[model samples]
Target: MNELDLIQQLREGDEHAFKTLVESYQDLVYNTALGIVQNAEDAEDISQEVFIKVYRSVHTFKGESKISTWLYRITVSTALDLLRSRKSKKRFSFLQRLFGDNNEPLQEVPDFNHPGVALDQKENAARLFKAINQLPENQKVAFTLHKLEDLSYQEISEVMKVSVSAVESLMHRAKQNLKKILEKDNEE
Candidate 1:
């Protein structure tokens, strides 16, 4: 079905349309979340949450932008929310640990390497992603959309609600920042 037809069906509460939506966009949503949150399990959870959000809130989506843009916004927002929640929990846990016997076991941080990387390249990929994570929010989103999602400047502009030139500037800055971060990592 065309996007228009799918959207209309979705607004009409068609079950098939919802299923098609999930099937068509799950990878996009999942990868975007993974790029942001840098965790596979959390990305999977965020992907499901994004769809549930779309299923609940599709009616609020005005047709001013493409469905994918809307999905991108939702995926980014949900992933960032998870990150913020995790950060707050971590901070609170640090405080809680100071005064009592903590029973929670600390797990090793999972390698956040891309799935397609070979074993030898996993370290490089993980290091690259860690630097990407350190970017300012706009630069990180633009870089992820362009590099990870293979989106053009026009597509990223639409998703980010920014001008194409702004996206260009963000991409340039992200590359420069990543270079510096990786260089520092190498030194350390």
Candidate 2:
């Protein structure tokens, strides 16, 4: 069944249709969450939350856009909420350090892949992910939904609740930023 048909079935309270919908879009939702959260465990939690929200609010989704677009919106919003919560915690920790005399270093150990792994495409992918991380939130969302998720400009615009032209602009800027970062890396 097409997405619209599946949505209609879901609206009609068909449990099987809901399962099919979840099965179809689960990867997209999970990956999007993973990109934003950058942690597998948190992404899994956020992905489940996205689907629950989608199932409960599916009735409010007027068919103005594709079901995938609606799903993307939910996924992005959930991830953003998680990011905000993490930021708040970090800020609180920083404030606590300012008031307390505990001089423990805040360290994050990088998880190194096996040294036997060649630095071919993996390095490029890492560079690309780093560059994507540096993008402003809106541009990052547009770029992630477009290049990473392979959503069309129209679909992203609907998901982001922006004009198609605006999405195009954000994507263009994102590409330019990535290109500049890559160029600077090459020069170094």
Candidate 3:
């Protein structure tokens, strides 16, 4: 069935349609989350949350954009929410420590190794991801969608709610930033 038909079935509360939708887009959602959050477990959790939001809000979805574009927006929003929550928790924990109630230690996120990357490229990919994590949010999203997800500039523009030219500019700046970050790391 076409995406429109699947969406119509989903709106009609067809369980099988929902299942098929999840099956088809699970990897896309998960990988997008992983790229942002840099953790497999968090990515998996965010993927589930993305579907939950989709199921709950599908009826409100207008057909202005493609389903995949909608999914990308959801995944990016969920992942960023998680990241913001994590930052808030870290600050809270730091305050608790300052007040002498420290019971929890700050946890560091480890380097992410995307499973789809070739074994020979895993080490380089890990370093690249580390650099990506340091990018400002817009550049990070644009770079991840383009480089990791292999999305076109136009598709990313739609997902990001920006013009195609804006996406192109973001990609260019992201590349330059990544190069500088990697170079500095190498020099050290």
Candidate 4:
């Protein structure tokens, strides 16, 4: 069925439709959460919370935009809110111990099952993720929605509740920041 049909089913309180919706977008939701929280555990928790929020609020969706667009907006908002809450905690001693002052020399995760990812690729992904985590919240969200999720500027602007020009500027600055970080990593 089409997304509109699925949404109509959801609006009619079809539990199966809700599950289908969740199953379809769970990865997008989880990855967005992961980008914000920067911890798998917290991301998982926030992803669950996002789905719950969606369940409660799905009826409010007016179909003015695609359901995916609405869901992306909800996902990004929830993730950013979680990040903002974490920022108010007053300390990052845990991170200090994990990444240390220099930020190079990331700890490795042994994933024997995924030979597609070379060790270097894994390390690079980790470093990239760490760099992303350091970005200002808006830039991080903009970058993740664009770079990681492969959403277009129009889609991202809709999700972020920003103008297309604003999304373009955000993406431009995010690329500049990420390039600088990668160049520094090369030197190290």
Best by lDDT: 3
Please report, as a residue range, the 10-residue window in candidate 1 with the lowest summed lDDT: 99-108
Off by over 4 Å in 2: 101-104, 107-119, 179-188
Model 3: per-residue lDDT, tens digit, 142-177?
Answer: 999988799999999999999999999999999999
| Segments in model 1 whose C-alpha atoms lie over 4 Å from true places | 97-108, 118-120
Q: How far is candidate 3 from the true structure (C-alpha RMSD, Å)?
A: 1.4
C-alpha lDDT of candidate 3 relative to the true structure = 0.94
The deviation in Å at residue 112 for candidate 3 is 1.4
* Best-matching candidate per TM-score: 3
| Pairs of colliding residues, candidate 3 | none
TM-scores for all predictions: 0.89, 0.83, 0.94, 0.78
Report the alpha-carbon TM-score of model 4 versus the true structure: 0.78
Candidate 1 lDDT by residue in tens digits, 135-166: 99889999998888999999999888889999
Better model by lDDT: candidate 1 vs candidate 2: 1
Report RMSD (Å) for each prediction in the order shown: 2.1, 3.6, 1.4, 5.7
Give the candidate order by descending lDDT: 3, 1, 2, 4
How much lDDT does each candidate structure score?
Answer: 0.89, 0.80, 0.94, 0.77
